[model samples]
Target chain A: MTDRSRTPAENAELALLLEVAGTPKPGNVDRHRDLDDLRFEQFLAGSVGSARGLRAAADGAPLGGAFERAVRGMSRQSGGNTQFGCLLLLTPLVSAAAAGDLTREAVRERCRVTTVDDAVAFYRAFEHVDVAVGDPPEGVDALDARRGSDAEPALRERGTTLWDVMELSADPDDGVPDTNAAEWIEGFPRTFDAAEAVLADDGAVLDRAARSFLRQLAAEPDTLVATTHGESVAESVRERAASTLAAVERTGSLDPAEALAEAFVDEGINPGTTADRVAAALFVALERGLAV
Target chain B: MTDRSRTPAENAELALLLEVAGTPKPGNVDRHRDLDDLRFEQFLAGSVGSARGLRAAADGAPLGGAFERAVRGMSRQSGGNTQFGCLLLLTPLVSAAAAGDLTREAVRERCRVTTVDDAVAFYRAFEHVDVAVGDPPEGVDALDARRGSDAEPALRERGTTLWDVMELSADPDDGVPDTNAAEWIEGFPRTFDAAEAVLADDGAVLDRAARSFLRQLAAEPDTLVATTHGESVAESVRERAASTLAAVERTGSLDPAEALAEAFVDEGINPGTTADRVAAALFVALERGLAV
Candidate 1:
């Protein structure tokens, strides 16, 4: 989405900013909506600061440590969970870029090296913000970030790596499949595929992002929506998105998508999981030089 | 615009983000517009990075060196002039915050201590981005940053410190008074005044900013608009802004301002100087703890 001559760190920063600057992102903190307790500007600061920190430490730190540090930085700066989902998705991508490759294999390789200490730090970072992670699998409640430092000992005793946590969270057949978890476990299939989509599509980068977001929302109900609202609400939102995209196809305009976004916001339904996926997609697109 | 529980640095970052996030700014790369070369995301990245860098160095670095480093840091990340005017205004204000006093006197005292090396570094930073600066007064052609290193010796020989340059630029009665210069020379009267305005306003901070921006534009023709589009066009834009504000006053709504913004964007008119003033004002408001 920017000039290709920039460093990977610079592009990573740009990717984070673009992720927040996406207008009409509906109930999420896009340009149009600034929540009473949380401002969009705070999110902007957190995202940029975290992206820069991740890129700077990507080469030296293991994936889990880097991710924890980035998240901690954002929490300290923003005083909220402004971009926890984004940090989870972007950490490995930045690591891959620092490794001289931007590929799913590279990201997975980086994730494979995460240690138990990294998991402890990751849990510790959660004390700084109210990240919206749903309830964990029944037995793995010890892995819950909201458990704070209390979960660290069990994580240590189980020798449960960050990747193990991702694998558990990523099981699509499970009752709850986090978009971030799915990307981590499946070698970031959707992230890479979305990068390819951006390359194939023709328009401004923001417009492409909007289209990609709709496609993702139409394809599946958002996990965040399901968690915060309900399965029925999420399913209805997905169906509405599909119909809106179909209308866009018929009318060749985004007016329907805009209307759909307004309705989602009016209903207080935030497809945050899908928004996180779009951030990951935009990161991949920027990393691979998909935008001219 | 954000929770007051944040640190001064975090508040500074929020100010930068809020400044640029103002929507429908009309041809100035607000939320709705991204130029062919410069994206709104780049501006976001620039503002956040600069704010962070400024705050991080505020306690130790001399005001001039801090300003140069922040600008250089932004250039490294964004590769453009997204907030040159803003950096000029914020650096001194951040210094004041770091000095445990958020006052024009404190900022002036900070600027008064800048040396010749800071001046040279300031010019050196100019090489990294295409900042929009007007020509200097007579006998100061050698002070122009466009001359690059060629001006260094002259600056040293003339003993023209950064403060002296600010004094020259701050002459508000000058044919081309820089908004940044006016803040520096006049001890930031306008910035402080706008902060008072925000404190008195009864609404969302973003809406306060929108109203403050329109008022600032209506009060005076933006020098950036004058430099780029000539005095007559700038004056006409200011007149339209005045009329729009009058309509808003009559109707108690921003619809008139929105309509005027649409027309301004269509005509390629950007009141960038007013936008910079608004950023300075937001910084002052944040520094003074003016928030609901």
Candidate 2:
């Protein structure tokens, strides 16, 4: 609503801050709550620390390099991997925004054009923090991110672009959906859709973002939950989110959502991938003039 | 400690985040609470929006212009004037740090060198938000910040530099102290001292910042409280903070601080000036390699 214009980097950083500030986001760290190991302040620190990388992305730095730098900066906080997937999603979006087009098509085009060097840098980023990415399928063990820079040779030999790697991981036959990867191949459909939802909703912008996060969680099984637990557990979490969101809709209250948040935190069921997508959605919304 | 080195602008932005992230910061907006009008997310938005101004300062822009830009950006959030005083303190510090030294002497020199244009810019910044500055002295009505750019002629006619204006306002004959202005004249003593306290304290960095905030509040009456609710109320708030700090020191527990925070918020007493100093202190701490 204010007249101040923000650069792509500023909007990306704002998106990170707004996403974490949205309260009662089930199983994710928000302003009011934190998981046992990750405090809300760490998310704040991660958001601040990632500014350089965000700026670099906005300045049209290569996607993998920008994403890796952002992850490295984010890992400066004690709470590890605070926004790894978020940065992974935001980097390309920021680049697209910087290119004067923040559309899904622009981001998808950027993703499609990523090179082998970008893929190598993406793997190298894993050296900075412990991300719970589970094991790669048996044949692709050599390309695991945990190998860090050691996987660069495999990536180069196979001519695997970052986009190719994303496609490989997008929808595994094992039933564990990598939503972050899926966004790459699918033109970031969830992020764009969620941005539209955020713009359509009323009340505070952050409150709208919390609602958007819940909607996304309800619509899709969070990949982090699927990877850490099982597909069924992820599905059940989605169902819980759906019912909680329905109750909120029915009563015009977020109280039910808060209860669900508490239960999810207590159960240690973090829907981190959904949170990451919401962060990207926030960026899109901000770029499209969704006011604070 | 983080191995990554940060620019002055990055440190300043991180300081804003860390200060707000610290919980149980009595009478101020922190992670766990909000005032009736100002929400924690607004602070986050303000911090994100202020980055360009912070960067401008670090890049050696004129102090008043940089500060005005920062305040203008911060005002983009619906919560008006979220960090005006904090930005006022940080702009010169960032300029000093960008000059390859973050010492008190460096910042004081920067403040002393500010021009009348800077003073005009400072006044112009007032137009962007509703700052609760109360009334100026009878004769200085022409120079009141509420007059905005209209005060420029008076500033020019009197040859008043920003530093001169700050000195005029610092430690006024009236009981209410302008601590932010006093820092301009006194070489930022409180900010540096509190930075040392943050560095010496144990546990999380945010916990240290919260403790630092309490210590600062205990040591001096908050100027914002004095301005809003008279000097006696400010003094009483300081006494309460002192007692609460003593309880925390005696029991090695922050539980007492939480109760005091609830009481202070209920009473609608905000020690905003102290919070501003603490944010500046956090910037100093971060620049000196205090870990997140």
Candidate 3:
């Protein structure tokens, strides 16, 4: 890893670009895969323009307000939901990076400072993209992200901070955590661990990232995969990934992974939530001195 | 193309990013293709960082110094050549964009004002990247770009401006023009024409870019191809591209171009010069409101 210093903006941009550029991630919109209505360039533009506001979130700016502006900037350029998951993951990490501590404790400290206004701003950002979020638990209908401005008064009445809302959705008791909410409630354990994995792997950074992604998917069934495809299908995909990774480990060839990627893409089983984890992991890696 | 107002920096970044993200341009190191040493992420980093310096160049900062700084910034992130050709083509155009007149005459006017110090700085930028420029013309060995700082005094003695050097290298007498120098002396005719073509093409922005690239490569034997492979080989490649384009037009499919791309990538024959021109064209297209 090169020991180059970086501003939070540069780090945020690199994390997002690296996320999209990793090839054969199977089922995901990679460099080679341009989904209809959601091309790769839109993602590139969103990531490039988002660095400033993401950095500001870590530099004492309100996270929700910064996120809203960044999302708006992204929407103006892309007019698509390219990197919504990534922005969800990166905003807090960017804040953690700016705070000069990448620890889970530090990130939790950052998240804890969020206010009802922050929750309102976070919901406002949802106006820009069609993110697939699970329904809020019973009796929280008024706080639905899809409700837009109508949710604001409810959020204000409850005096719920963004952290409180994340706690509501983290679903820790379910054994399979909701990705973004889990990051907030648990102070981003998976993100930090994935970064550790990035540093331990030894190869070209992109190749390492690709390998790490397979490991990530194999280790945890993606939340997005579960959301779109049923839980059984998501589990099956995870098992397939595990087997593919085992073969690569045995033969030291990336060929099997390529085949697995083809199958995943053909079936339209995109594990986008896992890809978001990779993005956050990469940010941690960069902050810890992973070279380009 | 976005109706949204853009600063010169935003325009430059978008153009550079879009240029590299144009997929299946084959043989060029784009989003899908990473050379052993030069990864796609590095190119993204280089382009992201250079926007500021390019904007400075257009904002009445001495063109040479600004260009040198921009190249240096790219090198710092990439640790290798990434967008030297693009920057050379963009410097004048960026200046034109900042001047609020992207017309050929306005661009020429911008070029004309470049000072000898600008020539020195242009030479300084050469230290950062291994740009594929031919040898200097006879009797002007003192103006060699590869000479770095050693060429400075000679440039000073001759009172050469950056525009003057480009004029010598433009080689209007040669029937085949150097893409970079030719743009300088002729006020970017091909670049402008390519932009017009982009606007005229109807499809997704990337598809339009890919089509424009094929057309550009078909129209000219890329100087880079000619330099690496013999002139005969370059001519043969151009002929193949033309026929491929003809087949695509006849069938209304980019499938034929995909086949051509496969052949070129297999042969390690890259028409990089043509790709650079396409980038300039895309910029012009965006500047003129060719929606993505």
Candidate 4:
């Protein structure tokens, strides 16, 4: 409510402007408990689809048919960002975040199911349907309204959450991959070589187990950094390594070994052989220690 | 990320933007997941003066500090419409939506005492130190440097969350209050007449039991509307009611009975006396078969 002179549209615009620019109304603090839970849900729900999904789901029935009519009616008032966020939160993102396992790919693959059914399943599981519509306005009805559109149309933008897919791609949501084959890959072996080469150059920066991790990082930067760096070094490594790779990854062809050589050389971390470079660095560190 | 041509700042920005935004690189995804967890925890773990709550808690300190900072930070972000929204949410303006009970304030309060000492002192129990961390950043490492600060600081501006407090003004974080007294005062038979007067047109629009919830609504319209119209409406009701009450409350001019009578009469719901005014609409709603 900016000034008395504002119009309805101005008032509406003010609401948004105030949103990114307003101050707190300290006098009337709601201070309720479920506040966080409610807000969290609001920021996260909603799904995406297309007229095709709607048509397929409807089998090309008339738009005003009983079910289709309900769908049409609801869609008119159906919240856009709110609904999208809900679908994103309820379906893709939850699986990405809630997967039993801890890998990025697993999280992504699991979240690929961004269908209404996926949302229904998630809500049924996540929200206690037995929950009473006790609060005024009783928003659980929207859950029912949301379910009504299950067989309804969706937007492409709503299909998958950017956040969820990103997470799953890097980390497996659950289940470890078969590293047996992963370790044998020859292309990645070069990274380990480079790591060893760097280590060989500056074992001065190395430690006892640090050599092993460095070797690991070089061998399979994905799993190596994923497991070793945890959140910190892993994130930086991936980003930095990607930058290096991007510079070389041009020409539209991706070769793991080539990517590593380019990234490693670009980073000034020698790219030779994984274990050898690791050994080279650790040997230097150990020798420096021994000399001391 | 911004559709701008390539630059170093853009390059660095893109890496974070892509990792956070999710990209082709596999490891980049992992970083996103870790950062997201931090983003979600931004409010919960945020401290009074601390940048991030998860980092602070992991480093070890009372949970209150981070959340308080989040509250202050979030409050600062919403510049103008705060009062407008607060007024609508407080009064009966947004009577169409409300979600649940357990609010962030309650949880924030929960975090305040998430320590072994506090738990032992009050509940006479103890929890593991990292219990406050909830689930660890799904694929994150504790010692990682990249996790230090991400888009989480920016995510902190999402705006105020008052659903819980609107439903129930007394927050768990503010220490104990005689909520039993508040509850008793709400449930008294003497409230129905006041309820009728407040119901505007009639107890007709509200479910029977919904009338009973009016006093609770008055206490915290924001939370009750969580189930009703969603957050927007919840906020509207609170803002309107608060502004009206604030306008009249300080005068101490009108007799309580007359003031309440006028409020109900204005609503077109007639109540003969203060006591009748409280009971009048509630009885009408119950008689009309509107379920709260």
Candidate 5:
């Protein structure tokens, strides 16, 4: 029943919805659970609100402008930053798909061609919502996202393209990789791989997405988790995901994962970056003919 | 935090999402519950898929063509007929909104102006999914929705515009009013009134939507339920809803409604048509500055 002819913008929006609808996605808002502040309906509103920006990306708008517009739209909900990182990853991929190919090389080419204007617009997106980002590395204070549009002069003076900024943030000094930034630098390896995992799995598409999310989280520490908590907590969370996934694989039951979901929510350990990557993977899978 | 600047298409899409996300809606799919066949994610997919059709409606496409396209897109999900009635109600409202006004008069004018071609297209949409529609009157056998495109000649011969078709179906021979069709004939009174109820209520927006849904169901028998199950059963369902609403109002708790939700789902009594009206009401509310 998959509608493969859907526009890239439609697929991206579906990915966002599917990611949030996936159940027992430990520590993140899903169909069956909600955080204290962020409810599931807010995510639905965010996806609906972001449609214009997604269409803009598919129509070949500048990356920064599209992302900023999407972020601003997403923030229309009381839940401030429901899909900031997801939009960050999807905007370029949608553009790449709109360009006639969704290959890694195409995405890489798109990322590589980003201009300093794109970088400035990306910083401007930060002004729309409160994203929990770690501090910029030593000498890059002028490019901190918290500086918002105020950093535009410095970005122009340094001749920093969006690609250059991604490279700067791809590997942080604290040893926690900025997974979304790394996707830009490395052409979305995890996204493509997890998409394959989703296509290979069984059951509902959203359930498949939940498993892919667990796999992604198990494979690496979530950047948002590392930034919000600490590297140690992030690593432990990844280990928990790895163990929970292994148990589910052996038993063929989601019970263990569901229990872990409750514990993770209670502990306030949200692997949001991993969830974002899973959403990107879902878009890739859907675009490549994964059934709904 | 509501984005009042969203297009009519965007508001319609959000209304679909919000309608499905509302919890504890007896006998219908919601964020916390799914029917044996239809999951929450399919509704999400339907909303995502229907965006183009919604845009078409907002862009002044022929009403039948827009509704047919939206229904076709919605059927992309495996769960068939996820939002058929909703699209039926929303199509004209979106078109009215697009025509520089969302007033009841505007909607009435749009409905009254629907062409025979629009009636044919509306009939054609039935071919895309198996909707649970009642049989047409004896004299109107050739206009049965189950006849799909085969009824087109009859529609053209009778010079039946979409408005005329709604008028024929609005008050069934059985006394079970087709709420969605009734919306067309009466200029969407229940939709506008239920929207006011949603806006006047308190907690989460989805919860308010759920309450409004209950009020609508309590107020009248759901045409779909009456068609699938007997009119007596539909009347009983409405009585249960009324009592549940009264209890919830008296106790200031949703526990009774939640219990009723479980029983209604177990009995296989889905008030899908009433739910569709709630979605239209939600679209009206969202368009008229209901906060997210």
Candidate 6:
């Protein structure tokens, strides 16, 4: 395989960028040309520079200010909650991986990647990364591993779209007219479109993730308190997890097509998952907004 | 004050919106605007139509559907839980309030604004609507409420900014950088700045309130399963709450904030506040976040 073919990080970056550029017919648009047209040339260029720096650091390429150190420093500073910082680190890492500048194994060793396939990738990454990033739990993997154990769709191909997963249900109490499943589904494309716009504009995934994560975190009691100070972020997170699970259960009974986020929380809350303790709470809220 | 001026719903909307719009000029340009730079036009239009219809309805004047509904519906929806809808409802209401259409009594009835201040006059077609937005909880009123609760600086009055109340601290674990009180204060101006662009482009006080309310709700888990649906949402929420309280207790020592949250939760979970449960959780989070 060529250097490009050998590098998963490069592949991931291309895939992610392609996902951004692709939208409908990802390949049709001259993504490279529009990179500047959209005023994202700087972000893309910065990614490349950061990617090279990451690879140089990972390879121990006699680098000064290696990403590894940045990661370690950020992790410690976050009180081990590197979810926010990790994204900053990973955006570059993924780009490097896509550029054939870094090895997947190296990236995993530096961190850990149980599976990047829809189920495995999300669940594993959830566990491996810090809570401030995207902590997933250990038990949460049973569902994914069950699928992973069988291997049907390849990684990146299997995850369900927000539209496909969200199910609209009529609440017996919500007699007020207007909003419906169709309206809800319609909301998704718009929100995703908006999210994409925001992401492209602000390449700082950590800040975005922090915002996204906080959107969910803001659902639990004292989460605002916990967020300002990490002292009880995990606990507030856990409480949020339980609350979300219950909501999912309610929504599940109310709307069958809607994904029940409780299972993910169940998995995430399990201490064995490392970060599941925090992930359990976060995943549900994130999923709810995803449906939007 | 005219009898119409005494309407609580109108007063509440004016009080809250002006309070938000004037919030000591966090440096967010949105703070300086005519109709919040037109971001909440739809909502404002809706409320204005509601207000006109209301006057017509009160006077028993002949009116069109839009106007009639606007006049009739202003006081229909219960303000039990501020975030009753999926989207956290506050933002839309903010737009309505900012429009300054609803009568003072209407605003007062909804938000229960206590002080005898501009919230009443700001919205009236005439002056001195009998609106009295309520007083803040005892100690919370330590800051002179009568003097400067307005979101904006009164024509020439000097007042403390939201910056005065913010607090921050550094973390000793995980090496995450501490969030400083000064930094939060500093960030407020920037947040205000970013918010202004949105105010101009689309959102303002309503959006701010909605986001803030959503942030509060996001921290308070939603799925209250049993009564909500024949699901585990309530159970999950309860479990998470217990866990969160536990985490709060575990983190170093129990501060006054935890006690407040615990009190709210204890009351909310036991007999249950039902619709107000989310509000209870949010209040707990805000209080906890506000604790010194």
lDDT of candidate 4 over B24-100, digit per residue (tens) = 11111111112212221121111101112222322333433322221222222112111111111111110110111
Write candidate 3's Cα lDDT for A149-256 as tens digits. 679999999898888878877773343457777888788888899899999988777777777789889998888888788789989999999999899889877778
At residue B238, candidate 2 shows an lDDT of: 95
Please provide, for model 2 over B189-232, each residue's C-alpha lDDT reduced to its tens digit, 9 standing for 90 to 100.
Answer: 99999998888889887788889989999999999999999989
Q: Give each prediction's DockQ, rounded to 2 decimals.
A: 0.25, 0.58, 0.34, 0.02, 0.59, 0.01
TM-scores vs. true structure, each candidate: 0.86, 0.95, 0.89, 0.21, 0.97, 0.19
Candidate 1 C-alpha lDDT tens digits along B1-292: 2222445555565676777776655556666566556776667667655754586556667666677767766664443788877778887887777677888787777778888887887787677678777777776678887876688999899987887877777673345766677677778888888888977887666678788888888888888888788789888989988898888879988778777777877787878778887888887887676552
TM-score winner between candidates 1 and 2: 2
- Stretches off by above 4 angstroms in model 6 are A1-84, A87-227, A245-292, B1-292
Ranking of predictions according to TM-score = 5, 2, 3, 1, 4, 6
What range of 10 consecutive residues in model 3 chain B has the weakest lDDT sum? Answer: B1-10
Each candidate's fnat, listed in order, reads 0.15, 0.61, 0.27, 0.00, 0.61, 0.00
lDDT for model 2, on a 0 to 1 scale?
0.90
> What tens digits encode model 4's per-residue C-alpha lDDT throughout A1-292?
1111221111111121111111111100011101212221111111011111122222322211212221221122112221211111112212222223313354334434334444333333222112111111233234332333342233123442223322332233342221211222221233234334443443112122232333344234333223333435444554554554454336433233334434443443321122222322222222222110
Q: Give the C-alpha miss distance for residue B125 in model 4, angstroms.
A: 12
Error of 6 at B141 (Å): 79
| Candidate 1 steric clashes | 0
* iRMS of each prediction: 5.8, 2.4, 3.7, 22.3, 2.8, 26.4
Worst 10 residues of 4 chain A by lDDT: A25-34
Regions of candidate 3 where Cα sits further than 4 Å from its true position: A1-6, A58-60, A77-79, A172-177, B1-8, B55-60, B77-79, B172-177, B229-233, B266-268
Residue range with the least summed lDDT across 10 consecutive positions in model 5 chain A: A1-10
lDDT of residue A40 for candidate 3: 78
TM-score of 2: 0.95
Q: Which of 3 and 5 is ahead in DockQ?
A: 5
